[model samples]
Target: MSESHQDKQHKARQQKVKQQVDARIANATEEKGLLLVITGNGKGKSTSGFGTVTRAVGHGQQCGVAQFIKGTWENGERNVLEKLGVEFHVMATGFTWETQDKQADTEAAQALWQECKRMLSDASLDLVLFDELTYMVTFGYIELAEVIDALNHRPAHQSVIITGRGAHRQLVELADTVSEVRNVKHAFDAGIKARKGIDW
Candidate 1:
């Protein structure tokens, strides 16, 4: 059998792409901590952050997490990660709407912020995930300047992941990488309730 013209063209295109990728790999030599901000109206923000934490753990890296607005509901990620020596500090105050207590929510946010600061400063922690942190800032429970300052002063080799609905512009501007998840469609809108293992 002989190769088709389409196959030939495909191979040529792939060869060119390979050359470009190789060149990029050769030129990229810098390695440092990365600040990744995942935010938007869609779901999976926390899931994405947890996936990265799992990756870091697989690589034998130290990881920590701060859940700024999570409720007392069971968290599968925390259950698994905690056994892997990943420290977690959760607000456990549920949603602001449910709590409906500004004073209590603010207190919880401040406490979590302090823990996040400690995690950022710890050189031993290679990766830290601030889950739902944007809510704290947006709700006026935490100071944006203080958050930025702590992030700026974090260990040079410590990477951080912040996940929430609405990320501040300042935080996005400072982030090395930012991903915004848009809500195109969701089952919940169709009267589907969040399942225990899947949704939570």
Candidate 2:
């Protein structure tokens, strides 16, 4: 066969293989529910979590959200999600750095975690977002073993999303999908405060 003809045949074979792979991915239903862990030192961790919550709500799925470190009043996402009947539980102690009390923060985190655990185990909830959850595990404020147990024990058809910086290796290993949001750049580093709708 001519060299060009051979190259064309190889390309055609590669296209056929690609089509088969795509078909498999499209038809595969072995894994329906997912454990998604989003972690990194950049911005938008909770934002990404909330985005997923919104998506789930739009799809007529019951969703729950538990905020770990942030408990400040009236964020746009919370307001929108609340209007959609999405369940939300905040830590009520605000950020750890602002509180400057480890014990107090831990206690608040534990309380919120209890609610999150219940939501996670509930088969009625299609999706549960654990916002800033990595902070609890990273600081040892919440028991890692208990968290793993709750995640593993959740309903087979339920999806869970955990977002925060410094996610534990064990949690990452347990997760069905893990996404690391790298910090390429941020306005905060340039002396600009977080903007409404965009940041919040």
The global C-alpha lDDT for each of the candidates, from Candidate 1 onward, is: 0.95, 0.89
Backbone clash numbers for all candidates listed? 0, 0
**Candidate with the greatest lDDT versus the true structure:** 1
Which candidate number has the best TM-score?
1
Clash pairs (backbone) in predicted model 1: none
RMSD of each: 1.0, 3.3
Candidate 1, residue 122: Cα displacement in angstroms equals 0.4
lDDT of 1 by residue, 1-200 (tens): 89999999999999999999999999989898999999999989999999999999999999999998889999999889999999999999998889899999999899888999999999999999999999889989999999999999999999999999989999999999999999999999999999887888
lDDT per residue (tens digit) for residues 1-200 in model 2 = 56698899999999999999999999886966799999998888888888999999999999988988876766898898999999988887977889999988888888888898899879999999998998899898999999999988899999999999889999999999899999999998999987878887
Candidate 1 TM-score over all chains jointly: 0.97
Reference-based TM-score of each model = 0.97, 0.89
- List where candidate 2 sits over 4 angstroms from the true fold: 1-20
> What's the lDDT for candidate 2?
0.89
